[model samples]
Target: MLKRRLANTDLEISPLGLGTVKLGRNKGIKYPTHFELPSDKEAAQLIGLAKELGINLIDTAPAYGDSETRLGTLLTGQRQDWVICSKVGEEFDNQTGQSSYKFTPEHIQFSVERSLKRLNTDYIDMLLVHSDGNDVEIIKRFGLLQVLNDLKAQGKIRATGMSTKTIEGGLLALQQSDCAMVTYNLTHADEEPVLDFAAQHNKGILLKKALASGHICTHAGEDPVQASFNYIFAHPGVTSAIIGTINPEHLRSNVAAAEKAILQQ
Candidate 1:
């Protein structure tokens, strides 16, 4: 339940955010184990549990199937109590069963508008580009940063960021936007520089895949979840770790581990 004020924004986010990927999309994921999508009632209960645990940040995306719409229905009257983060670059196609990436300024605006309507909210707390690799090229050729800046200026989103796949893109995202989402866990330390940059520059850093996409292969007697949270929150730049889990007991354990990690810190 520890909070950090995200840089370049007025939002105060919890150290562990509730990632809503499993609430919607299930196919074509890289998670270690196949998952059954949670029911609407289950998801609503999960959302309530997350909020009860004092998690203020909810991460969803257009690429996450109907996550935004589910949250819109589930979150109903709790809009003012949470900071919602959605994405622009990639969209999930239910028919083709695949995700497509588009970042033309036209598409960017269109995505923002659609997200606003889907989320049943007037403004997004933050918007990130869901990258499909080629991150540097995407930023250089697509005018994504400018378009997101424009959206922010227009008050459609409060902040802009990129869920980057590489170090170069992470660095570029931090330089050009309010935050960057990067993968950082015990097995992967390559993205630490992005976190270091975020710390040095006072930019926000949202850690993705911190538990290594649920393929957390740990030695006997080692608690991967606790260890992952400990390693992540040890870094000052980590604004939050976006963990997607629908089970209430798993959520409770994660929260307890996160609290312990913060207390130890």
Candidate 2:
């Protein structure tokens, strides 16, 4: 695996990181039946396979129902080697079948503590503020950046970042916070100025939704996986791309894309 330095942090993460949104539930997809959650045993085996295959970064969020818990259970004794990036400010309600965002400082603290407990780790490698739309409101309501600074000082979280769905939100986060930024690749590519701004500021950039919600790889000979992965990897500012898959074969295929990128680079 190719390793890249996350901006202003000591952590060196793999170019390909695992996103756990699918591991929990098919959030945006409609299905006749609820998506089956992976068993703990299977999750553990996959985590082991990931480690063995040189994948060092695993990104999860509290909003990803049971994902953090499952990862925690799987990674109980092997926490030191992995860069476990988790998000706060949002959670999933199983009964309501919806996600709710919270931004109070109290709620932020509560969320982090719960994450720590669920992750079975004392400190997070990278803690991201998961935002829905109101970046300023969310930042002000919780003073989240300040809280993250305090947590860093207290050694509860090594670094902080923001995961946003908008270019405006990405730029605002970069201007206001010293932490890193995560955003969708397709939207970001369309807003090159924001990406350039982040690069100029030395802000770490992580690309999510790299596969365009599976639109990239839905047809024969299209190979959206490789195309999307390479597109993001070729972007100078992007440090890593998060790709999610439950199938081991598909996972290997994604890993092959990363390997190929490294060789070409």
Candidate 3:
């Protein structure tokens, strides 16, 4: 349960954040297995369990179906108790299982406004551009980062960032924003520069796909989740890793593993 300030922001996120992808979207995901959506009661219980287990950061996005709405209802009165990290730019359509991206300033503004209403919050703790792999083009051409910063100045968002795909994009995001989300785990270390730069420049860093979207394999008698936590938390640059799951046992286990992993730092 190690909490650290997310770069220059006031949000103190835990090393392990609860990802709400499964809480909202059950289709068009990259997980190894398919599953039914959890009941509202179950979803609320899982989120409460995450908070009880000392998770302070909760990652959600508009693309995550109704995650923001569920979280808003669940965390209603206890808003100040947790840090909510939501995204913009990319949206998902559950009916057709199709996702669309728009990085224009107008879309960015609209997305933030909609997310604020959906989450029932006046201000977002963290906001990231849900990239579509065209990271360079988005940053260079769209000027969405400026819009996020403007929102930050307007007090609608506390921090700004991008969920980048390429290392170059990751580095550039660090230079321009308060944080950047990158893929880093036992399987994928190609984005280390992003982590390294974040560490050096005092920028926030969040790890995505740390468990390889639940596809990581382990050796006999070894724990895959614990191994992933150890690998991710050992890095000082990592602010948090977004792990999406709806199981209470899995959340407890991951939190325990993360607590142990962070102690090593």
Candidate 4:
């Protein structure tokens, strides 16, 4: 559970971050199986266990149903103990089970303000632009990165980045911001160049869909979880991999596997 400095930022994060999507939303997700949202007590227990296991990074978003609110309640009075990474540009509707994206400066301002209110926090450690697949256009056309940097300058956010979808966009994001969240599992190494750039430039890179949303973990009869972690941590630029497991056993097992992977490095 050793921590790494998220490059260009003061925040130090664990190798494996706990993604909180499962704590709030259950509809229209890509997980292999169906699941009920965890109760408040259950969510609190999971968060506590994660903190005890040396996990200080928690990834959430307005698009993740009520995750921000739940974490806000669960982590009250202990906000300083963790580095919270939340996102803007995407919002989820539970009743319709739909998602919407808006990256206008006004919407970005509104989203960050609402997230601050929902999380019951004064500032976010990292604020990422939750892209809607039009990564290049979002950066070039909308100018949301500038808005994020403005927020950073205002002390509302410590760092700014984008959860990018394309190689060009990932590179561009790194050039303009503090970090980039890119996909880089064993099956998805197309984003490896993004990691290389981050490593070369001393920027941060957080991995998303590192296990292919739990669909492609196993490979050639190997221990799927171990193999996945091994591939993820073998790279030099990955600041952390966001794992969204709600099961306590799965969390523990993932941490163990990640630790082993890091030790091998």
- RMSDs, each prediction? 1.1, 2.3, 1.1, 1.0
Query: Which candidate number maximizes TM-score?
Result: 4
Q: Compose the digit string of candidate 2's lDDT tens values, residues 1-265.
A: 9688887789898988887776776654443334567777777777777777778999899888788888887787789989999988887886677988888888889999999999999999989899987876677666787887788889999878788766676776776554445555543466455567777887777777777655566646756677666667766777777876666777888899878866665
| Model 2 lDDT at residue 245 | 66
lDDT of each: 0.91, 0.76, 0.90, 0.93
Model 4 misplaced stretches (Cα beyond 4 Å): 218-220
Span of ten consecutive residues with least summed lDDT in model 1: 213-222
- Candidate 1 lDDT over 59-155, as tens digits, reads 9999998899988888889899899999989988877779889988899989899999999999999899989988899999997988899888989
Give me candidate 1's TM-score against the actual structure.
0.97
| Shift of residue 58 alpha carbon in model 2, Å | 0.5
Better structure of 3 and 4 per lDDT: 4
For candidate 2, the lDDT comes to 0.76
Model 1, stretches more than 4 Å misplaced? 217-219
Q: Candidate 1 at residue 200, lDDT?
A: 98
TM-score, every prediction: 0.97, 0.91, 0.97, 0.98
Candidate with best lDDT: 4
Clashing pairs in 3: none
